[model samples]
Target: MNHAHSWVHAFQDRLDLAPFGSAGLALFALALKFGYDDVASIGIDAVVDGPDDRSVDLVYVDRDQRLAVVAQSYVANTPKGQAKASKAATLRQALSYLIEVDLESLPERLWPAASDLRSALAEGAIDQLYVWFVHNCPSSRNVSNEIRTVGATVTSMIRAHFENSNIDIFADDISSEVLEQLYTDTNTPILVNDKISFITHTTLSFEEKEWQCVIAPIKLSDLKSLYTSHETRLFSANVRDFLGMKAGDSNINHQMQKTISENPQNFFIYNNGITLLTHGVDVFDVPNGKRIDAHGLSIVNGAQTTGTVGTSEIEPPADAFVLARFISTKSGDLIGDVVRYNNRQNAVTASDFRSTDSIQKQLVDQMKRIPNAEYDGGRRGGVSAAIKRRPNLLPSYSVGQALAAVHGDPTVAYNEKSAIWSKDALYSRYFNEQLTARHVVFCYGLLKAVENEKNELRKREHNHEKLTKADIAKLEFYRKRGAVLLLCAAIGECLETIADRVIANRFSLTFGEKDSPEDAAAYWQPTVKAISGLHAHLEKAFSDGLKNQEKVRETLKNFSQIVATLRAPFAEFFKSVENKLS
Candidate 1:
């Protein structure tokens, strides 16, 4: 099958298994296209029946983008007149619903997604509300314009409700053609150059390995063209993203630009050369200088330099120079090593190198063995394997969070951005020997179960439809701070209880030791059963906490208090397990 067809088939399989059918699949496809690491369907219903979906079919909050996407799917196998009308009506209703609903009064189940929207709005992180009208059938220009009009109306309403928050509304009709394009995997071939001339050349040796380096002076205009043509994809293989230079700042970029404009001759000496990785390079004699034709040229370092040079306001001198290091290697593993070495030289964060660690490799292999578990270790191979094998599984970052949770620090896992992968204290905690593949899977299961329950609750709320004012008020209470963190803390408390029991019994099946992986695999069934039992109790605790509703929001806001609240109940539940073991 072609790439598009294969992706469609995979999505179909997921839809068959998923509770929120077409709408959920559309959301997932969109999430993948936008490079979101994790997404859960917050749709209200499985099927897009008539009206009454309350206009929003699915919602996804992306923290990285500080964006919340609310989508309404209109899938019609046969685009008859009635079907088209229904689709159009649904789209209009979705837009109206978004405008009319008070975010603070949303049902409790939606609070997870809504809380993100609220946070972004309050922080001014998000300025646009994207409402996608996803349709299986084709749409015309007239329909698109109508949708845009509705979007403008919603934008005005949102501004009014949000205290002139200046939130824009973008409405687009994603037709079948667009969906196919989104799913299609396109691999663009990189241009190959055999020999490229450099004004100056040098050699660097690291650990007995020699690297060929050269300084190349190219027109600043040509560099801008390359950047515009390739965009961010040019830096995909690099460890760090391009940090743009500020006008008033006296950073390295500013100094380099200054030298380029003032004395072009000194540009080569003042600037650190861009480090590049190529599959191979060939040398050829030319008139003024030699030609270096490189294959698969990627910038491994000097992103800031490139960004600064490309975006500089003043015209660069014709003779401005950029240092280039050409490393010729076709091996993917070697490319990663070269990138890591260059990034380390530049003082990049430890998180960038976590994927290369021995323990991470072992964990990736173990996760692959788990049924339905997909682990992308941020490598090209791992990412390809995940796309081909298990497209529905959460991304590597989510798996990292699970690792953090099981390793006994859900607080950091819940909050800190990118710290969980650090090689110092945080990384040590995550890869602690006590953590087994099974523990990771168990945590994964708990998260999935909780997400599933949240979806089901949304469905129930939608079906009931007649929520009283008091009912809405009570739910609003549960929607306050620390609600999701409370869930994480409860899981942590349960695991702590399990650890205490195992230590007291001095059982052969211990966790977090050197042999924990083997022990976890050996005792997989019992461990899963114990986790399942604990999960049931934890779910009850959550439900009870929601029902009590009195000061629960305040209690949940404090991490320690949330854990303390759950500790006794989890300890009591573990007592039965200990007795059974006896």
Candidate 2:
């Protein structure tokens, strides 16, 4: 069987285990193919019984795009006509229900995902909503038009509800033919200039192994076309991603776009040209100019320029020009060198170079050993595996936050900024062999406990319903501040009181030396008691802050001062506990 057929067979075998059958598998496969993470296959149909499912089968919220995608999958093994009709009916019902129902009123099984979608919509956290119909069978022409019409109706309803929101609906049929094409690696020839031509190559001859270079003036529109056709995969090999233009006026892409808009003819002079890596290239002479055909082309530099020009709302000028240098190499070793050389020209963050770090790998391995703890070092597969195995563990991004918090830099955690951890200076200090995965797991537990305490306190206060709106707002503020202060104070106390002994003994308070389940109960006993004692004092601190709301508010405004103010009290609290224990 071909690659496409193999995929189908594999999915077919797993259909019994899949809650939504083959459709769910197809959605998951599509999500994986597109590099989307954090995909949740919400089995709304299994729990809620109705005429049919009036809810989407899959929901994924893209934080980068600020978009929520709700997808319904239709997998059919029967005749095309019957499949098309069935898919159309399912699509129409799902869209209509989305338009008619308030998300908050959704059934309990669907409530969590629906609540997330609704929250994003209500808070303006998302800019767009994508309603997608994914299917394996081919859709008829009439059914296609029907799908578009239903989509339009739903879009109108959503727009009427949300004043400044955009909604787009898409129907994709993952037919055998389409899947075959997707799986096949076919290279197409590209036209560089009047005299230059580029063709893709799967293999290179011994004679063609020599490096060939070409310098040409390529049109901005052509570059944009390539970017549009390939999307992110075009720059997949590049070290840096296209950092899109920021909303304000501080970004380089913003400035470059402005310049291009103002002077189309002078863009070549204003912007640096892109450097590209290719597997093979051929040079030929033409009447007016030279022709260069290149294979396996990827932009090694100038991703920002290409991204801005291609995706910018303002169209690039017709007269705008960019210089393109094509370097051909057959050796994989040479390709690596080229990538490193080009990327090193610009300043890169420690996070960018983390993939090759030995410490990161060690940390990931250590984290995996922790019971019910998952770590993937932020890789795609790692993150997916971690989430699947231990959904309750902190997200991969929280690794850095936990690190900073435990390392006595709670200011960074309080401010919720990742810059300090991404920088070499601070990351090098804390992320070392000295800090084991056990330390991370312990710190994460403390943070989770504090979060749980805050939630319980909030729920208790809400149940009372005695506070005014202003007072309630003040209480919420205090709750957040109290959680951070308590967590930081607890981490400081743990380090001061226990870290040395634990390190010297090669033992953890949460897990003993053997890392056995039997030792966990004994290990966590005192730790739990310490946390409980700290919680009472933290509650008292919160109560005092609530009594002096104005003073707490002013103090909390400065994150540095808040950390400083909490330190002495936290220290005193720890000392009192130590004295009591003695």
Candidate 3:
């Protein structure tokens, strides 16, 4: 149609691409003819929270910039209909497409090229490797915590993968002398955790590990709108003008032309500036006069200082005309569709398709139609055979070996690419530590309870343990003094001990029977050691901890059960306050 052709012409200039003047132009002519109107002005068909809905078929994954788009439609659409409609692409899918698709030749197909559009990708300045991860949360306290855990997991995976290679494979593969120099330059790693989020870094020295963590309550809606709107508003001017109005009033109408001219992407929300606006919507109300809606005409910004007082309304036409114009002038709809399709394809593709079929069965089906010669080539290990083996080289195939593969030649200068920790190891380390810390704190409390009951048994005057009533009474007095001293030690260890007399007084008050100073000095070492050991174990695990989750959980569960079992007798023993007054 002539209408669709206009769009094709408009975008060719906008994208700095040639008008469909190519050898393959005829092959795609039918697609362009049918989809020209709808693809020219794309929009999300539905908003999905997850993957289960039948409507969702495509997703858009924006790069490091914090923007993403996805869409879904009912299953009835045809194969050609599917091609014309754009879908959302997941990060993994986007990466693959980016590598496979040639941007130069297919400008109309991949319009809104990553660079042509304005996005947080440029704003955030995320030049380093970009990571997107999916995960499961054991307890659903905070859904966003899932995002934080994924990030940490990816970081650890990278570090471990690199560390092993630096020590093993890369060292032998590259010049040894260069490897040592590179190792010396890196710092001991640090990991910090706030309740909600954490970051980790490392240095060469092992002395101290540091972590930076943050915890905040964030609304998911705020994040989605913040980034999504910015990305959408990047390419349209008519939408921009509609958004600049401070209040829907007469004055805005007078200056409407100026607003649209100033901010073109109003058609889509970009720059966090014009977030909510759409074409073919009402712009001004005449009440008794004439009511003007969005579709009738487009608004442009004003340059002149002097302006008309009344809504200097310019009449365009009807809603359909405006809709037609929007589709004519902008490619937002098409780009959004592409993003949606990408996501749908990604979700379906990434799913475990091999679940029902064996690899041999799949190979047989794939080879059935191929000529015997082609099958023979594959059997003999030709190009197709090499492709099959590539997955084996990926780190996920065997996480343990992946640990050794990430380090680039330690002998050479650091290569920024694959030489970082693998994703699996990093996730394993942090998840294990948090679980272990909770277990240790619980056990430490139980140990002290057990100690208290044993001390109680030592001085009880009952003949079951020692002497008669009178002798027992005397022993009781000493037991009371000793109990007080122990309590002081617990407090000093549990809390802090200042330079005041309280620390020494707590111990002195409990000395029921006079004893040599040497006796008190002898007890100090063991008590300090116990407290020190508890702190060290917890801290070290918090640093590197256990990388394998199953092993760590099993260990923690055993420790917690042991401590809980000891609680009964220990509670009874401490149930007696010293009978000093009696």
**Model 3 segments more than 4 A misplaced:** 1-547, 569-582
lDDT of 1 by residue, 1-582 (tens): 122344556555554225554575555555434433343322321123223446566665434334557777665656332224345446565544444566566544444444455555666665446777776665576667766776777666666766736444667666665565554422211232333333323333232244444334445555555566665555655644455543444456667677656776676677666877666655556766656555556677877777766766666665666657667654555655576667653321334466676766776777666655555453333112222334535455555665554444444555443566644787676655555455565555444444444344445555677655644543333233323334544444444354454332121222332322223333333333233333323333234323343333333334333444555655554443233332
Better of 2 and 3 by lDDT: 2
lDDT of 2 by residue, 81-162 (tens): 3345455546556655544577556543344345455555666666445555555554466555666775677677667776
* Backbone clash total, candidate 3: 80
lDDT of each: 0.50, 0.50, 0.23
Q: List, residue by residue over 1-582, the lDDT tens digit for candidate 3.
A: 122223223323322111111211211221121111111001111111122222222223322212232222221212122211121113223333322334443222232222221122334322123222211111122323433443344344434433321100000111112112222211100011111111112111111122111111122222222223333122222101121222334443324444334432231232111111122222222433322222211111111111211122432111101011111112343323222232222221111122122432343343343222011110111111211212111111111111121111111101111112223343233212222211111122222332333233332421245554544332222222112222222223232111112332221222112221122223332433233222222221112112333443343334334434444433332222122101
RMSD (Cα, Å) of candidate 1?
Answer: 8.2
Instruction: State every prediction's TM-score relative to the real structure.
Output: 0.61, 0.52, 0.16
Error of 1 at 85 (Å): 12
Pairs clashing within candidate 2: 195-290, 195-291, 196-291, 196-292, 197-292, 197-293, 198-293, 198-294, 199-294
